[model samples]
Target: MKRMIAALIVAGALVSLPACGNDDTNTETATRTSNTAESTTVQISSVTSTADLGMIDQAKLAAFVVAFRTAYADLSQDRDDESIQEIVFSSCNAIADGATEQEVTKEIRDLAANDGTEATQSQAEQIYKLVTPACP
Candidate 1:
């Protein structure tokens, strides 16, 4: 009877050990998941603010158009359609409330040069609203 009781106790201890280990692993996993979720939430909030500011402020938008035109003229030697479009879109989108024509032009030119393209007339015209209403 004494030996039987000892064996039963040993069996219980073995089972309980695994349970304790499993609990620790579960706790660690939960902690990691919670931290990951929090980080993702922070990133999402930052992206939202950035996107909100990405929208056009009309005056600055006009300046961006002017910049794109200037840059296009400067880089007309090696123009690519896709690159021009990209520069026009990116520069116009950068226009904020108080941006100047020179500032916008410089941005557009820099973007165009970096992307290896000249701004197209159509793309320039599209962005031109940020600077002039009569850009054809």
Candidate 2:
């Protein structure tokens, strides 16, 4: 189901990218893309295979997770610029601490690939709360 949803989301992004040139429509596209990514299931257990993932840095990992959640929240709330900016800002600490966006994205996709859609989303909300306690 997650794969199906993700596929749908990618399709939406693809559809929106060239379909409209207006900023308002682009914003909607961005929101749609952001929502799709946020709704996409992620697994945090990518660190289990040390050889595959290398030595996991917990702080960087945390930063990525928090950034991931913040992006979703910002987009869903209709704050387009903030949504886009926060993703970069929120993940900066992790990136500086040695986390690459590719690494984080790969980990998330790996986790998403392994879990049930509903369960993964539920877990994501829980993880979001844990990572950004002050937000809620």
Q: Pick the candidate with the highest lDDT.
A: 1
Clashes within 3 Å, all models in order: 4, 0
Tens digits of lDDT, candidate 2, 94-131: 44457665543433333323223222444434333333
What would the per-residue lDDT of candidate 1 be over residues 1-136, giving only the tens digit for each residue? 3433354455445434433547778688667656765664454345444333233332233334334444345653455443444454444345544456656666654555534554554444434443332121
**Candidate 1 deviation (Cα RMSD):** 24.4
RMSD of 2: 14.9
Poorly placed runs, candidate 1 (over 4 Å): 1-79, 114-136
Q: What's the lDDT for all of these models?
A: 0.46, 0.38
Q: What's the lDDT for residue 31 in model 1? A: 75
Predicted structure 2, TM vs. truth? 0.23
